[model samples]
Target chain A: MRRARDPFFWGLFSGGGMLTALLLPALFLVTAITAPMGWFGMTGYEEWATLAGHPLTRAGLLLVAFLAFFHAAHRFRYTLYDGLQLYHLDALISIVTYGVAAVLTVLAAALLILVV
Target chain B: MKSQARIPTGRISDPGYPRASNPEYTRHHPRWYRRRMPIFWWLRKLAYTKFILRELTSQPVMYVTLFLLGKMWVLSRGPEAYETFIQWLSHPALLAFHALVLAGLLFHTVTWLNLTPKALVLRVAGRKIPGWAIVGAHYGAWLGLSGAIFWILAGR
Candidate 1:
């Protein structure tokens, strides 16, 4: 039997959700919470630039950003469908949802590559 | 046969909503009107409300991802550009937004962690691993990753 394409998006959603759940909060703690609060010595601009400049770190950041975007797109799409009762527009909604994620992922990749 | 004859045959009382033409069938199995799902159905149940909130947390995660990307773009421009971005983060509105996002992130982590075990079914030597063990493994991974990132950023 032919399978639906839904499993592919579901896989991306699950992978992205797992990564965001596991990694994002810690990132928020350091960058948004602790660093700003002066809990530890403020990280110098050079250090952040160096980390962002590293190829491996840049790649990891890009993966995180992309996965998070896809996960959000999937969730938001369902929210609009079930919560808001827009099931009639599922085709348009899926296109807009995943399309935005794809665009952002491309933009993120471009920016990451451009980082020096 | 007499009861069937007494029943209406040709048309239903409410033309807008049709019923079975057979009176016996209609009498035996009454029409069921399914209640329409309310737009605010999530608000009706605590579990549903939590589920919706967890889903809503995705928005902030998306926002933060965009913010991080923007930061990287500014950083590529030079130290002056990055400094300008940092200064922009100090705005009260932006700070409040970050705080809200942080709360959402926390909620996302907790709920996601709680749900992880449901997705993962582990078996060892024909014996199923306990649910708590699966949950524990996820938490362990989370702590290890968080610690690793912290050490990378702060240890040096």
Candidate 2:
């Protein structure tokens, strides 16, 4: 039988993204639990706004935002297409989901530039 | 659409012949799609746009990023810097962005909350955890975090 479009690539990409999302909570949990105890050899910045001045922190935040946005966009698009029986509008749905993801990437970048 | 044409019910006396072929299935226009192709296309695109916008606006990245950055800032300098940063977050422009991000965050939370059951397994004794339970947990977490922040700042 002739093979249609390959689903393997997308399956891998999306699966990896979901794994990242699942891991994020663990990081957050560790931070929350350890922070109060002062175990990580970390010190607080003098001002909360200082994060805006720090390039690494700002960039990391933006990266997280962009990834999460794109991941959610992809998942939601498929959920709608399959679960909701939206076969006819699949192309339009794809375009819009990607569009939103792109805008989110832009927003995250803008935030990083302005803040960092 | 004839199944008999595709499926050979072997009637050979010798019964030694084997047949293999890809069968053709009927293509359907699902009544609704047939009558509303143009309008469906337009509405479909519009709905697609809405979904995309919804996902983009409600990213968890925004909140989690800000929170982590705040945590990191506190770590680098001390509580003082973090406090100052929090205070600065209320700056007119920053606050405006905050408002927008908050709206997005809420939208994301609400929609994803509904996806809890399908996305994750929370079974017990061969029974699955109710979606409402998952949603309630999130709501509780959100409230708890809000309260903690409020308490910390109010006390300080």
Model 2, docking class = incorrect
DockQ in order:
0.56, 0.11
Number of clashing pairs per prediction, in order: 0, 16
Worst 10 residues of 1 chain B by lDDT: B14-23
Cα lDDT, all candidates: 0.80, 0.52
- On TM-score, the candidate that comes out on top is 1
Once model 1 is optimally superposed onto the true structure by TM-score, how far is the C-alpha of residue A39 displaced, in angstroms? 3.3
Off by over 4 Å in 1: A1-5, B1-34
How would you encode candidate 1's per-residue C-alpha lDDT over B1-156 as one tens digit per residue?
856554545565634224445434443667679778988999998999998898898898897787777766776788788667667776778788888898998898888889877888888999999989888889999999999878887656
lDDT, candidate 1, A9-33, per-residue tens: 8878889989998888878777765
Write model 2 residue lDDT over B71-120, tens digit each, in one string: 55454555566556545654677656655655555555555555555666
What lDDT is reached at residue A55 by model 2? 78
